[model samples]
Target: MAAPYRSREGLSTRPGAYGGSSDEIQLRIDPMHGDFDEEVSGLRKQVRKLRDVAQEIETEAKFQNDFLNQLMEKVLMPTALRNELPD
Candidate 1:
């Protein structure tokens, strides 16, 4: 009894590193003609911007976690351990 989306092979929503140029390639959505190529280019630029932001956030979170862990081990944990030691 497993969920359809979860087979342990990873999530289906994660776009692959090389998912191909479908996003870059354009399709004529309207017969009358909208600049579909330009639209796709804009969408690709926005996706790139979003990816950069996500990477920055991930880096910041990692830095904060590492800093807190170091502080706990170097300062708080040492002091607590020292207090607990018998004379």
Candidate 2:
């Protein structure tokens, strides 16, 4: 299961990519929308923003985990127990 994508408009939208399988559910899109290009531009911008946000989150999580591990080893570990951890 994947997380639902959220757009800048705060609307939760299914991903724009389509599965080629014939059994997949088809969604109805508004064909009469004023400008298709504008819609695509908006979606592109939202996707970029989401990608950047996800990357930032991943980097931050890694940094925090590494920091916590170092902090624990240096401050929480007893001298006798330090050797128990793998180098």
Candidate 3:
């Protein structure tokens, strides 16, 4: 069986002398310290930096692969066929 929900005006519940609810009475409270906006901004900056680095790495890898493919076709193919020709 569920207990009935009561509004603040209808209920007699009050914080103790220390100004905390009974459920939270036993726990020691810490002061709030974090700036949410600054933390989010820092994370956004890190993400942008990582995204830029990843894009640079991807572009370099693609260029290297294409260059290697062209070098192989232009240099190795003729040399290999020359070596394999009947002489």
Candidate 1 CA-lDDT value: 0.62
Per residue, candidate 2 scores C-alpha lDDT tens digits across 1-87 of: 232443333344343458543332222346674456776787678679989999999999999999999988877668657778688
Per-prediction TM-score = 0.56, 0.57, 0.57
Please tell me which model should have the higher lDDT, number 1 or number 2.
2
lDDT of candidate model 3 versus the reference: 0.61
lDDT of 3 by residue, 1-87 (tens): 122222212223345568654521122223375555655575577669979999999999999999999988999889999999999
Error of 3 at 72 (Å): 1.3
Tens digits of per-residue lDDT for model 1 on 1-87? Answer: 233333222212333359752223223345365566765686677679979999999999999999999987888877899899998
The lDDT ranking, best first, is 2, 1, 3
- Go through the candidates in order and give the clash count of each: 0, 0, 0
**Best to worst by TM-score, what's the order?**
3, 2, 1
Whole-model Cα lDDT of every candidate shown, in order:
0.62, 0.64, 0.61
10 residues in a row with least lDDT, candidate 3: 1-10
Q: RMSD to native for every prediction?
A: 9.5, 7.1, 19.0
Error of 1 at 52 (Å): 0.6
Q: Which of the two candidates, 1 or 3, achieves a greater TM-score against the reference?
A: 3
